[model samples]
Structures are given as structure tokens and as C-alpha cells.
Target: MNDMRIVERDVDTNEVKIAARDVQVFYGDNHAIKDVSVDIDDKTVTAFIGPSGCGKSTFLRCINRMNDTIDVCRVKGDIRIDSEDIYDPKVDPVQLRAKVGMVFQKPNPFPKSIYDNVAYGPRIHGLARSKADLDDIVEKSLRRGAIWDEVKDRLHAPGTGLSGGQQQRLCIARAVATEPEVLLMDEPCSALDPIATAQVEELIDELRKNYSVVIVTHSMQQAARVSQKTAFFHLGHLVEYGETGTIFTNPVDPRTESYITGRIG
Candidate 1:
């Protein structure tokens, strides 16, 4: 039975990176997310798993206030990153997003060159003082994204010219160029082939060494492979959250068990 549990790795610290308390999201009259509370640890990968329209992705967007972009969407309750209230009126959403970077389902790189694609964030955030500094940032971010080797020779090439996997990696580089504390991914590999999915999964593991990673994935296998913690959502509610192994092997909630065993989704 012990062999059935997934091995949990040690992280840099036990400190909570992002904390959400009784969060609720409403799109017009529809309550999209309901009362989700969780403490996501620093330097760890946390995966949100649930059926479509279960609010897992909705909750992920709440961490970085991405939902704010939708005019009809309204978020309620406290969400803090490193103990700072991100919802405070004084906090700038743009600046907040820089601190908490996000990668969407599809690879949407800028129409500019690969170098410019990765450099855009740092340039906009004023992270570099000189051209040399900007160049270094671009190189480092691409290396961190795990695609520097493939595209190093074509730094000036159009970003959209890359293969699907490479473009996704470029987008990741763009996200990290701002040196965000948290990385939010919404089904980042759904558009990729198996080889690309494997590469991104490997990158996700490496990324947890520096930033807290929160991913919304429909694949339970991907969650078990990449995350230390797993969260299950159902019909706008967070049903269970705990160590990934425990959630998969010995879930306390019947709903989670049903979902895990394919009885319900």
C-alpha cells in the first residue's frame, strides 16, 4: 500500500506563497466559484483538477486577479500573495500580474522576434537599464523556459514561426522575464503533442525550484506527475485539497473518490 502513494519531494520552505480565504467569483448573476480557501506553498507545484466548468480554472485566475479583465466578472474575499492583499484598491492590477505571471491554454507569442517576445515583459516593467541588460534577461529567461538551445541561433526570427512546443516555451520565457513569484498555467499542454507535453511537464518540475507553480489541468496523470499538492473542484466548490498522493490514493471526500475513480466528473 505504501508503494501506491506518490513520493513527495522536499521544497525550499514550508511557507505559504499564496493564500486564499473564502473566495467567490460571480459572472453577472452566476456564482462561478464558491468559498475556496487554500494555502499554496512556495517552491512547490500545485495542480487544480476537476471537470469542465467546475471552477478550477476560474479559481486559478483569482490568484493573479486575471478575472478582473472580464467586465462582468466580480471577485469577493481576500487573496494574498506573500501576505499582501492583492485586492486592495491601492494595488495596481498590472503590477500584481507582473508579480504573478500567467500562461494560457494556447501559445500566443507576440508577432515580434523571439528575442523581443521574451524581452517584452522586462522592457515594460523596466527591469533592464541597458541593451546589454535586456539581452542578458532574454537569454536567461529562454534558458529558464528550457528552449534556449533550440532557438538560440534564431533569436531574431519571428516568434510565431516556431513549432507549437517551442512557441509555448517562448511564452513561458515571456512570463518569467518579469521574475514573477508565482506562475499560473491554465492547461498549458492541452494544445501540444505528447513530446511537447512531456517537455513542458519537465519544465514545470524545474520551475518549482524558483517559483510557486499553480496549474489547472484536466489530466489527473499530469497532476500526479508535476504537482506536490492537488486540489479537486466540483460545481464551483473546492471539494478536497492535500498532498497529491493522498488525494489520489486515499481521498477523504466521496466526491473526490468518485471523480478519481471515474464514477463522476
Candidate 2:
């Protein structure tokens, strides 16, 4: 195993928090991912952009071992988080998820109070010692998610009672409450209005100050606005990966250019 260290860009700047090498996935007879590889940096946002069925989301699931739930799914290759292989048999998915939480495309809040939504992770992971600790975690997480002040007075309200944007924020709070080192989001803004989308985007920007964030998005403009690095996937292969500015302005691969220019999917 290679000693995975951050690929530094300058004297004081380090890039890449997670390194994936020769990663591939197969669902029975169908190969869902090819030999895809890339580096994700700490405290930065990396956006995966491509057409539908390009395996962006599939690859994202591999980071936190979400694909393990599927009985037919088979994954091969090495994915290291801070130089530790996350796929080792001894590595528990539950614990891995605690370190690398995820927010799905849909706003899926449990049938519980908004406070419980944020407190759920700490409770399950035993992160809090007492009621006061749990309460503190819930409040802090909600605030970090940018919805605490709005719901501070009514913590007991059902999470589903909130609007789509608010529910999504609640999901984000739940994820952050786990104190995850990496946060994975799959099309977080796909279901919100323009205003709500902007709000979530801003929250995502703020999130990058503390955790490495990987987002799979179909919106090229969104990727350009929120991500420092961008990786383009096409038909299960990572076509190109580089600085977001370079990828958008001058992509190295023809497939990437074609997709960006509306020439092909």
C-alpha cells in the first residue's frame, strides 16, 4: 500500500484528502465503473459533473461504502482516507459513514422532530454524553446547517413539516452532527427553487472551511461556482480532473469539451 499524502500545490497549501486508484464497480454482468481515479482535497469542494448514467453518483457512493448495501454490487481497487483503506474487511460501514457522512439527492428526513433529526447521529454514534450534550450538538449542528435560528423556537416540530429547502438543510444538519471529516452530497440543490438553491450553495461554501466535500452535480454552472476542483465522468470513466477553472475554461479531453459545449451528452 502506498503512503497516501496530500498532493501539495504550494509551500503551505495541500491538496487531496482522499485518493482513489484504479477503482471499478460491477453490478452482476454490467460494469458500472471503469478504472477511475482522482484525488479529493481536505477542506475543499470537489464537484463531479457529467451526464446521467456516467457513474458520477456511483463513484461517490464508493467513498462512504454506500454501495455495500447492494447484494450484487462488486467493487475493486483502492480508496484511501488519510492513507487508510476504507474497504478493508475490518472497516465497518457504520463507522466509516460516521466519518464520511452523506446527503442524498432527495431531502429525506426521518419521521421525527427537527431537533431529533439533528441529534440522531450523535445519539447513534454515542458522540454525546448527556441530554445537555445532545441538545448542544443539535443546536450547533442546526446552526452550522444555517437553519437553527429559523427553527430554534420549535425544535419539536416534525422535520417533514418544513419546506423542501428547509428539509434539505435539516438533512445537512443531521450529517454535520456526526462531525464527519468528509461530507458527500448528491445533487443537493436539484430540488430547490433558485433562492433556496442559492442558500444551500452558500451553506456548502461555508461547509468547506472544515470538511472535505464531494458533490455530484449535473449543473455545470453550479460546479463552477462552488467547487475548487472538478472531475468529469463519461460512461463510467473519469475523462478529466483538474482545477475547476481549467476544466471549465480549457478542458483537456474532447469528451469533456463536447459535454461542456452541448455537442454530446
Candidate 3:
């Protein structure tokens, strides 16, 4: 356990960025997620790890109401952000999404120029006031996404024309442009090469300083490398949730230990 990337306590969770209590998700007859509750802290990186179809992604989406898009998906129980009930009727899903950004498994950039793609969110959310202001936002977001140097000269180039990894980074820039308080990445590195994956992983760690970052990744080593806290899911239940080092080295649940040890996943 001493060799663990980290085996220490330095995080403060009293400030919850997202809270889910007794949460459940149903896609028609299939229960995708079971009763689960966890307080995701502000300015922290939390990883969700589990076997395929185990419901990590489903639960991640719940934090941002991504599940609302599907006609058949239904969520039960309480979910809140900043101590405000997110599921309340007064909370618009569109506005809520702006507060909680998401990056997907694949890089799905808008089919416009790179500048326009990064500018899309701020434009819609009315975050930019003038042309110069918008330009600053675009540059700042690209810098935060760590792709400014690579795409700076190609501002007018189509976003889809970039390499797969670059496109993913562009998508990330687009997400952060809106100044979301919480960022959710669902297998964001699944489609990238190792180098690209490493770049994105580094960005994820940096982003935790500005946004609560929640990631769902299959790689146990990736979780240990990037996250301060980790949640292990199995068969639609959160088997264990704790510090990344402790979870990887001494998981309280046998299922989590099995998944991390390569016995089952």
C-alpha cells in the first residue's frame, strides 16, 4: 500500500458540489441504477469505476440530469447541487446543464470552425458581452483545455477536421467555456491514443481546481493517477466509495477489491 500513488488525507468534503441520496434510475423495466448516495465535493476529482453496464455512467449523468433527455429514463430520489434540489420543477434542465458540463466517450465537436465550436456555449448561455469579450473567453477556455497552442493558428478551421485527440480537447474547451461548476466526463479517454489520454488526464486533474470533476473510466490505473476520490460500482450499486489510494489498496468491499485486482470486472 505504501507504493500507492497516494495514501493520505488532504481533501475537505463539507462543501458538496453535487449530492445524490437514495437515487435510482429506471429505463423502463430495466433498473439501471439502484439506491445510492454520495456527496461530490467542490474542487475535487472523483472517479467512477466498474465493469461495463454496471451503472457508473448512469449515475454520473444523474448528477447533471443528462438522463432527462431519454424519454424512457426515469430518476427517483433526491439530487442536489449547492444544497439546492436539482430535480425541482423550478430548475430548468438547460440552465442546469450549463452549470454542469459534460464530455463524452467520443469527441463530438460541433461541425463548425474551431472558434465557433468553442464559442457555442458562451454564445447560447450569454456569458460573453462583446466580440472582444467572447474572444477572450475562447482563448481562456482553450488555454484551460490545454489546446490553445495547437489550435491557435487554426481558429477558423472546421472542428471536425482536427485529429481525434485534438477534437476531444476542443470538445473539452467547449465544455469549460460556459464556466460550469461541475464537470462530468464519461469515458473521455476511451477514444484517444495513450498520449492523448495522458494529456486529457492531466487536464482533468487541473480542472479540479476550478470545477468539481467527476469521471467514469475503465482503467484502474487512470483512476489512481488522476482522482483524489474513487467510487466503485457493481451490478448497479455503489460497492465502495472512498479515497483513491485506500480504495485501490484496501477496499472495504470485496467486489471493489476484485475489480481492482483483476479478478472480475
Best by lDDT: 1
The count of residue-pair clashes in candidate 1 stands at 0
**Residue 22 accuracy (lDDT) in model 2:** 98
> For model 1, how does the per-residue alpha-carbon lDDT over 1-265 read when each residue is reduced to its tens digit?
3422655545455799999999999999999999999999999999999999999999999888899899999999999999999999999999999999999999999999999999999989999999999999999999999999999999999999999999999999999999999999999999999999999999999999899999999888888888889899999999999888889998999999999888997
Assess candidate 1 and give its TM-score to the true structure: 0.97
Sort order, TM-score high to low: 3, 1, 2
Poorest stretch of ten by lDDT in candidate 3: 1-10
TM-score of each: 0.97, 0.95, 0.97
Candidates 2 and 3: which is better by lDDT? 3
Greater TM-score among 1 and 2 belongs to 1
Clashing pairs in 1: none
Candidates in descending lDDT order: 1, 3, 2
Task: Report every candidate's CA lDDT.
Answer: 0.93, 0.90, 0.92
- The all-Cα superposition gives candidate 1 an RMSD in Å to the true structure of 1.6
CA lDDT, candidate 3, residue 32:
88
TM-score of 3: 0.97
Q: Write the per-residue lDDT of candidate 2 for residues 133-235, one digit (tens) a residue.
A: 9999998899899999889999999999999999999999999999999999999999998888898999999998889999999888888778878899999
lDDT of 3 at 141: 99
- What is candidate 3's lDDT per residue for 1-265, written digit by digit as tens? 2335467856756487788999999999999899999988899999999999999999999988999999999999999999899999999999999999999999999899999999999999899989999999999999999999999998999999999999999999999999999999999999999999999999997898899999999988888888889999999998999899899888899888888889997
